[model samples]
Target: MNLEELREYCLSLPHVTEDMPFGEEILVFRICNRIFVLTNLERIPVSVSLKCDPERAIELREQYPDKIVAGYHLNKKHWNTVSLEGLPPTLIKEMIQHSYDQVLAKVPKKETLKFI
Candidate 1:
């Protein structure tokens, strides 16, 4: 999906907010103030850095060598960088959803109550 489509999907999730703490070039999607998805706004083909299970992250890197790789400047074991062009839109959306769920899981129940 394109940047706009990705942005729209992320915002559709519960208690999601958009931020540019990394300046105008990088857009961040957060849950309870913790980052889960990040995209570089100026990049031609959108690239998203998403949180993922450590093992799955490694597996994906091996499977999609050219399109998916270790997260740039992120904790590699817990994240992966996904290029929109190389993967199907449905798979990308699933990855985004997984990242959102992972972050939400880490958040305290009291804080996430508002999302419900």
Candidate 2:
């Protein structure tokens, strides 16, 4: 998907918001005030960094060298950069959900109940 589509998908999730805390060029999506997805608007190929399971992150990196890589400027063990070009839309959606779930999982029950 393109940047607009990606942005829309991220925003569609519960309690998700977009911010440019770093700059206008980098778009960050958060759930419960914690970041889960980041995109570089100025970059070609429209890539996004997403939170991923550690072992799955490594496997994805090896399996899709051209389309997936270690997260840029993020903890390598828990994040991944996914290329938007050729990957299936369903997979992208799943990754977005995973990122959202990861962030949601960290929120305390009190804070989470506020959103729910």
Candidate 3:
């Protein structure tokens, strides 16, 4: 998906917000102020970094060598850099959900209540 579509999808999730905390060129999507998705708006071949289950992350990397890889500047075992070309949109949406859920899971109950 394109950047606009990706941004809209992330925002469609409950309590998700887009911010430029780092800068205007890097779009970050957060839930409860915890980031789950990031994109470089200035780059061609739109891509996104997403959190993933450690084991699933490895599996995806092995399965989609060209489209998926270890996340840049993130824990390689738990995050992935996903290339948004030739990848199914449904799979991308599922990955986005996984990233969002992972971030939500880390939030303490009190903080999560604020989003709820």
TM-score, every prediction: 0.94, 0.95, 0.97
Compose the digit string of candidate 3's lDDT tens values, residues 1-116.
88888988999999898889888899999999999999988877988999999999999999999999999888998999999888999999999999999999999999889878
Note the Cα lDDT for every prediction shown: 0.92, 0.91, 0.93
What local lDDT does model 1 show for residue 90? Answer: 92
Whole-model lDDT, candidate 2? Answer: 0.91
lDDT per residue, candidate 2, 1-116, as tens digits? 99999998998997788999999999999887889999999999999999998988898899889999999989999999999999999989998899889888989999978777
Cα-based lDDT at residue 111, candidate 2: 93
Which candidate number would show the highest lDDT if scored against the true structure? 3
Which residue pairs show collisions in model 2? none
Poorly placed runs, candidate 1 (over 4 Å): 114-116
> Using alpha carbons, what is the TM-score of model 3?
0.97
List the candidate 3 regions with Cα displacement exceeding 4 Å.
none
Q: Write one digit per residue (lDDT tens) for candidate 1, span 1-106.
A: 8898999999998888999998999999999888999999898788999999998899889999999999989999999999998689899999999999888899
